[model samples]
Target: MLIGKIENWTKERNYAHPVIRRAIDFLDETDFSLLEDGKYPIWGDDMYARIMTIDAKPRAEQSAEKHERFLDIHYLLNGEETIGWQSLACGAEPVRPYEEEQDYALYGALSEESLQAMKPGMYMVLLPDDIHRPGLSETGASVIRKVVVKVDKELL
Candidate 1:
């Protein structure tokens, strides 16, 4: 997992894959305000971005999920949210088996977890091995607008 301000992308570019760098560049140059909520293709199915407007939920109501086929770049566009993350190697039991069609598996409560407070312009990169629970609030539920860029694992 990686978290940083999009504005400082240049410094981090060296550490990212070329495809990921391209996605970051596209996000850096695009005007998200002009884009509506939905999936937008960038490089066919290999890469895409989805604009989402979601309501924050409590920790108990949210579930930790991990994707096997893609890495998620969670970018905050408006409002704030708290996302919990735990390493898949930490021994958290899966609540359900992975759904190949959806590329995700839900996990039960994590015995070890870390939280990240994300505000507008900040982004978090979640790899396939990272179990993340997004759209949570530190105080209480609130609405937030964000974009998720999905890059195929093969691209990395």
Candidate 2:
């Protein structure tokens, strides 16, 4: 997992991962206000960005999830969000089986879980091995708008 500010990424464009660098470029170049809430293709099926608004809830109300085929860049647009994350290596039982079509799996409580406070200027990169629960409320904020860019693991 990686956490970074949009400004920092702009200043330091030489990210080690080419795909992640392209994802950051997508965020940096687009005018998000012009687009509606939906999926937008970047590099066809291998990469796309989903823009949506979610009602932030408490962390306990959410389930930790990890992806198999795709990695995610959770780029915040507006409002505050708190995300709980832990390594899948920490060991947790899956509450639901993995759905290959969706590339997601839900897990119960995770060990060594920690929270990350997210704001509009920041983005988090979540890998296949990262168990994450996003959009948890921060300071009682209700709504959060974010662009989740999904990149196929094959691109790594």
Best by lDDT: 1
TM-score of candidate 1 on Cα atoms, chains taken together: 0.96
lDDT of 2: 0.90
Instruction: Give the per-residue lDDT of model 2 (tens digit) for 71-112.
Output: 999999999998899998887768998999989999878878
User: Which tens-of-lDDT digit does each residue in 1-156 have in candidate 1?
Assistant: 999898999888998878888888878888999989999999999999999999988899999999999999999999999999999999887898899999999986899989999989898989999999999988887999999999998976
Model 2 / residue 87 / CA error / Å: 0.3
- State each model's C-alpha RMSD to the native: 1.0, 1.0
User: In candidate 2, how many Å is residue 99 off?
Assistant: 1.0
Model 1 CA deviation exceeding 4 Å by range:
none
- Under the 3 Å rule for N, CA and C atoms, how many clashes does model 2 have? 0
Clashing pairs in 1: none
TM-score of each: 0.96, 0.96
